[model samples]
Target: MSSSSSMNKYWIPHLDIHKKVITQELQFYLGPEATVRSFTRDGEDGFLITTPGACLTDEQIDDICVKSKEMWEKQAAARAAGAATRVLKRPLHQPVVISKAGASESTRRRRESRRSNETRSRRDERRRN
Candidate 1:
């Protein structure tokens, strides 16, 4: 499609079958105000759907296209720079801290201390009785 036509329509990249379905769907959903048409560019197929009450001037279209191109270029440049600086190399393997089987040293000590405390309390209770 020509650049002139693109300015006045919302271009949708799709196959022929999808284009028909999308056109019907848009017509159904948007009512009669929506205009759907097929267009070909460099042998690639797509659809151009016109918005309701959309009347953009030639200058406006040119300005939009220019702005879009500039934004796309900026984004592509930023992506390229990011990719170049990125570090692909990772650590050989994940770091894992494996504890010994059963309880850890600190846990065993705490458990033994608790047991002694319980024994002392029971002995004191027996003496009182």
Candidate 2:
């Protein structure tokens, strides 16, 4: 296997990052030695993470795996919160439509008032003409 395909590598095959600075954000969390880059292979878009080995001790690989998992969990939770906030910022403004049977008294009054105003305006416009 190639050196780039070692155990220290991680591949994310489906990250939507065109509008995100996820690479710089992750590298900040994972430390300066961490490398994040994009690659295209087999007609698929992917991002790669090369784990930093410069500060690793002579211990087993479990430590790196544990740290990686912790960092990823934190990042995922933050991203989820950001996505929710974006969703909240967009309030739907669709016009309210209802059946006559379900209409309230205030709704009927408002509709009548609007129709009266429209009719009066048309009459005034005809007089002006």
Candidate 3:
């Protein structure tokens, strides 16, 4: 018997089917529990995007594919931007006082005193050793 038998054959082609697609797959599955209505409206709900199996027009389907791709690209770029901004080169907290002094007489005196004290401590340690 031919596959297009009267008993099982459909008079209208698959292209005739049209359905409104407003909700996303996440929203669809996240709705009520599985039922016969769910199967008739949306295809199998076994962890898949509900938009694919819907009987939308060819143009609508094509537009959906293009828009979905664009959206995915935008989302990827946003994620990369977020990650880049999140990373920091410097430490978490900044010091309250930077303590940078110009080459004044007091600064010169302090540097000389620090060096003399350091050398004296090192000489004493070396002599003891």
Candidate 4:
């Protein structure tokens, strides 16, 4: 077997969900030395935990498995706790639709009022003069 292939068989790293791989966010969080071997969707919504691999002796691999499991369990617990916590949700406003509907109601009222007041004032000044 090729050296790389052999290395993969013993120390290959990958992560997949059923078949597709996970995002870079999960990979970086796993640390540089960890290689994501595969991932399985955790629930109906497709939450996932990626499996990782590393090059190690048999003993080291065993220790790593234990440590990795601990880390994952802690992370999962933290996630569950966070999810249970209440958070304020902000409303998103969609874009307003504009049309050639002339001026807005307020603007039109203001302009009409201003013009009427000016006309009345001009008439009163003429009468006084």
lDDT of each: 0.63, 0.60, 0.45, 0.49
Candidate 3 has its poorest 10 consecutive residues by lDDT at 7-16
Residues 4-118, candidate 2: write the lDDT tens digits: 5443766555333431344545545556656767876687887666774432232423344455566677799999988886654435764566655546767888999999999
Predicted candidate 1, C-alpha RMSD: 16.2
Candidate 4 ranges with C-alpha deviation above 4 Å: 1-10, 13-55, 91-129
Write the residue-wise lDDT of candidate 1 on 74-128 in tens digits.
7799999999987657665656677765578788789899999999999999999
Which portions of model 2 miss their true places by more than 4 Å? 1-7, 53-129
What tens-digit string does per-residue lDDT give for candidate 4 at 11-32?
2233122212233333444444
Worst 10 residues of 2 by lDDT: 54-63
lDDT of 4: 0.49
Clashing pairs in 3: none
**Count of backbone clashes, every candidate in sequence:** 0, 0, 0, 8
| lDDT top scorer | 1
Using all chains and alpha carbons, the TM-scores for the candidates as numbered come to 0.34, 0.32, 0.31, 0.31
